[model samples]
Target: MTTTTTLKEQVLMTLKRQQANALVLYLNYKKYHWLTYGPLFRELHLLFEEQGAAVFASIDELAERSLILDGQPVADPADYLGTATVTPSSGQLTVKAMIEEAIANHELIITEMHQDADVATEAGDIGTADLYTRLVQTHQKHRWFLKELLAKGDGLVS
Candidate 1:
């Protein structure tokens, strides 16, 4: 007999994916933090560290949410790459490239969280929905910061 996946299972899967993405994003941010150099070295270094910490903080919350729902979080580090939607950065990249990559990942996470939050809400899991709602704000803020760094236009003084 074939068994259909329950709403809880779907929610759990989403949570796992989120957790994996958080870990991957955090690592990528840290990579950028360490590798970033140029005229904006100090500013970019601190900014990347701050954002990486924020993403790292959510990893635990996502994992706990899975446990609370009677599901398992992706426990093995080896599994993160397979589960995460966000792709990891590799090799040395230009500072601009790092910032652009981060912006793209943040955008990806923001979109996924909105969709995941809806799925959780549909499953009657308001707590999970609320978590996603709150976490999305962090990604949005990070994305905004990264985007602003790339903005170039005439200013009042220029």
Candidate 2:
């Protein structure tokens, strides 16, 4: 006999995945913050830290949300890697590469948040849906910042 998952179960799964991703993404941002160099070091360092903090702030909310839904979040640090769709950063990378990687990560999270929010709404979990909606705004803002940094410019209107 096949067992079907309930809507609450689906929301719980999304919450757990989001919690894991937030932790991993926060660490990745910290890595980039520490390893950044070049002329933009100061700016990039500050930006990374700010962005990292914003992502980190969401972790507790996601975990608590799981609890509110009568589900357990991914609690162990060891499980983050397995549960998160957002991969951690490693190895050496230039400033540009770091920005690119962060932008990619933000895009991934934003996409997931959009889908997850829809699922929560469908499940009548308005609270979870609102959380995802708010969190996606943050990710989108970060992505826009990184994208603008990478945008081509010649300081000419021609």
Which 10 residues in a row give candidate 2 its minimum summed lDDT? 149-158
lDDT, candidate 1, 1-158, per-residue tens:
01488778889999999999999999999999998887778998999999999999999999999999889999998999999999999898988889889999999999999999998998899999999999999999999998888787323111
Candidate 2, 137: how far from true, in Å?
0.2
lDDT of 2 by residue, 80-131 (tens): 9999999899899877878888999999999999999998998999999999
- State TM-scores per candidate: 0.94, 0.94
Worst lDDT run of 10 residues, candidate 1, spans 149-158
The model with the greatest lDDT is 1
Model 1 misplaced stretches (Cα beyond 4 Å): 1-3, 153-158
